[model samples]
Structure formats: C-alpha cells, structure tokens
Target: MILELNDVLTENESHTLSFMASSGELMCITGGTAASRTRWLLAIQGFSHISHGYVCIDGEPLTERTAQSFRELMAYAPERLTTLGEVTKYEPPTVQDVFSLKANRDIPISNGILGEEMRRTGADVSDGRVQLLAVAVLLDKKILLVDNPPKETSGYLKNLAKQGKVVVVTSDEDEIISAADQVVEI
Candidate 1:
C-alpha cells in the first residue's frame, strides 16, 4: 500500500508535514523533538488525529472510525518510553517477554526464527532500541513504524523496504537518513 500525508497538521503542534512512501520504499523522518516524531508515526497509524490535511493509504483517507482497520495494516516500535519497563539502562527485553504481549500472541514466532531474525538484523539484544526494532521486524506488517533505530540495521531495513513493505523510520542518525529512499526533516 502507498502511504501519503498531505500538509498534515497536529492538534498540539502547528507544524505541518507532508510525505509519501509507496510499497518497496523506505522513508526516513528526521529532526524535531522525540515527541514530535512519535506524533507523526501515531498520526500515520491513525492514533494521533490530524487536525488538518489527510493521511491516506492507497488513496483511501484514514479517519477516526477507520483507525483500527488502518492500524491492522501497520506496526510500530518505539525506541524508549518515559518509563522503561523493568529496565535499568541496558536492561533490554528478552525475546520471549516481547512476544508474550497480548498483541504479539497471535504471531507465530519460533525459537530458531527468533534468534535468526535478531542475528540477521544485527540487533544488539541488550539494547532496548535494538530489541524494539527486532520486534517491529518480526511483526511483518504492511507498514512499519520505527523510532530511533540503530545505524547498523540500515541494510536490513532497506531489504525490508525492498520486500514491498512501507518502512517508515524516525531517526536523526546520519547513516539511517543517508540510506533512505526519501528523507523528510520534521
């Protein structure tokens, strides 16, 4: 599916954003504060309402009533939240724990596949950011929303995009931005 945001405006922030990424494309979102980047991703996923303009997929506009349907086609991975769950800086989540979440229970994840996915993506396995990214990749959704990804996974993310998945990553890292098919500084 093709993701499009045309002059979109948020409720709390007046900053307007416009972007698009078709299937097999990798779009990078850079700049702005962490909250702003998260807002953009949520807005695209139909959680954060757009005060103006539109967020559309395959030419169909995303609205409040259809937000859940839109989200069904997407998956998001946040780098770090205000409160780290059972974390003490470097206390990354275990693969088993991540997949144990209610939302992930339906996905068929195996031990071999789990280890391979993490290893293939070069996920640190000890860093929260990398762990989150690994989970996002495993979700295998049509649209992937990631925030603050490690630079080492650029190639994997690129490959994911090439596989016809719309990969939208939010980062300020030069490596990630440089590898994107398109870059937009929010």
Candidate 2:
C-alpha cells in the first residue's frame, strides 16, 4: 500500500507538504507546535480534509465516499475519542479496558502480548506504551499513525515497518526522528 500527499495544504498552518510513503516504511512528521502535525495526521488518516493538494491511497484519491474504507485500513494511537465515539463504551479505557469493548470482545488480548512486544522493542511497560501497541495489535490496521510515543518504543514502531506496515508518527523525540525513512515538516 502507498500513501501520497501531493502538495497538501494544512487547515491552520501556512504551509504545504508533499510526501509519499509505502509499505515497510517508517515516516515521521515533525515541526514545532505551529506545524499542526495532529491535523496533518488526521488528514492523512482520512478523518479530516486538506484544503489544498490531495491525499491518495495507492493512487486512489481520498474522498468522502472513500474515507470510511480508507480509515478501516489504518489505526491511530492516543485514540481520538471524539472522532471514534468508542469512548461511549467507557471513560478513558486502558489497554485492558479496550478489550472489553463490544467490537473487541472476540479478539484475544493478554498482558503477555503487550509485555512481549514491549520487551522486543525494549520500551518500558508503561500504560502509555501499552496503549500505543494495543492499537497495532487489536485493530491490525495496515497503516499506523500515532502521536509522540516515547523514544524507547522506537524499536516496536520499526518492527511494524519491517512487517510491511506504513507507519507515520508525529514525534519530537530525537531518536524517533532519526529513525524515520521520511520526515515532513509543516
């Protein structure tokens, strides 16, 4: 799968970015707070619109009719409660709480999976780290977009990229930035 942003304009920023990411690539979008990386990530994930340029999946333009399907192929961490509405199931669900969601009822979840992934990544087994990795495992989304995960989890993010997943992250951590195959600064 491929994600391409052709001269895409931001909703608030006075800048435009053009980038292309393919499967097995780890891309990071970085800039000061003014960069509005979250908005860019939302646009890339098909949750919001770009005022200029275009975002496409495998050359197919992202449109209202296609956004839902596009979203199903991706997952975002630090979950967007307002957009997803999954919060209705519970208030600020943790990794364990997530498995209790009706949609996730059938999917197997265990502390071991989280532990092992964290162990492999060498990230501290904190609640924040578990939250990020849970999105990757439970949802099994081909594309992963996340807010600034700790630099220690860089290994797991890279593991996702190695598994042919397009990983786009909004981060300020030096190691995370250095590890990206592509970096777009808004």
By TM-score, the best candidate is 1
Off by over 4 Å in 2: 79-106, 127-129
Residues 117-146, model 1: lDDT tens digits: 778777586776766776677888899988
lDDT of 1: 0.81
Strongest candidate by lDDT: 1
Candidate 1, residue 54: the lDDT equals 97
Error of 1 at 111 (Å): 4.0
